[model samples]
Target: MGCMQKCEMSLGFESGSVTSDQISCSNQEQYTGWYSSWMPTKARLNNQGFGCAWLSKFNDQYQWIQIDLREVGVVSGILTQGRCDADEWITKYSVQYRTMETLNWIYYKDQTGNNRVFYGNSDRSSTVQNLLRPPIVARYIRLLPLGWHTRIAMRMDLLMCMNKCT
Candidate 1:
């Protein structure tokens, strides 16, 4: 990844629908009130009060949060922040995406099977980012946390460039 120069245009969460694998609070039968924190706004990290989605109880399996852009767009970069209330953060992660109406996911990787490992935030308050070279044109993006110390948690934002400037 190289330095991300600001483009004249940038697309964000406001441009799409976001969802996650975290259990919601709607189904009372399986819902615990504590896990009711999957709202898209929780990823903004503006304040410290439950500012991130606590996916599940430290399950060793991979957990993910995804965004549907509703249409195809070129994703230029990703910004991530850790859970503000806890020291836990995703130390290693990989990204995969799919284009419009496609069920197949394309892993962001090099010629080698190894995918790019994003070094996540070291502290809860700070932010980390990974800028994609030759931006990926896709409508669906998924963040898979591959490494975790305690549990999987993250606040993410996508940067997309839709138009070119002189």
Candidate 2:
């Protein structure tokens, strides 16, 4: 079964920014949480740190984003919140990963039989099973949106990263 670990790097973001490159990490210590904006441009700022950049392309329509972990490592697991937009509902959601050098994202289910699976359809809360693997390093990670009940904006909450085995 995969274990969960906390991200060692800091997450910094700028409010009202339209691009990821504009999200500065200069004062990495000043960042305490994740930042999301509804700008149509893609920008990310990682002055001295190294990590992946992600943003939800379907803003105001669906809450989703994609990450590329540059390198592969043992991914214990992840915990996220179902914070959809006003009057919106998230019927299904999933987490997927792929090698840093590849373009295809290898789903956890197709990789190993031992994986933690969670489902959130009602209260928007769940803890899926744990996939304990040999630190299979990957480059790309994607968050896919399955269903939307309302036409309002889509939001997510408390998206936490777990243990990263190198």
Top lDDT model: 1
Residues 1-166 of candidate 2 have per-residue lDDT tens digits of 5665764222222122223432221222333344334321122222111111223334342344554443454454433333322333345555566775446656555345633243433422232222324333565544455554442112222122455666
Candidate 1 backbone collisions, by pair: none
lDDT of 2: 0.37
The parts of candidate 1 lying over 4 Å away from their true place are 1-10, 13-31, 38-41, 45-47, 111-113, 164-166
- Lowest lDDT sum, 10 consecutive residues, model 2, at 40-49
My TM-score estimates for the predictions, one after another, are 0.75, 0.43
User: For candidate 1, lDDT tens digit of each residue in 5-34?
Assistant: 453243543233444332121122332466
Clashes of each: 0, 26
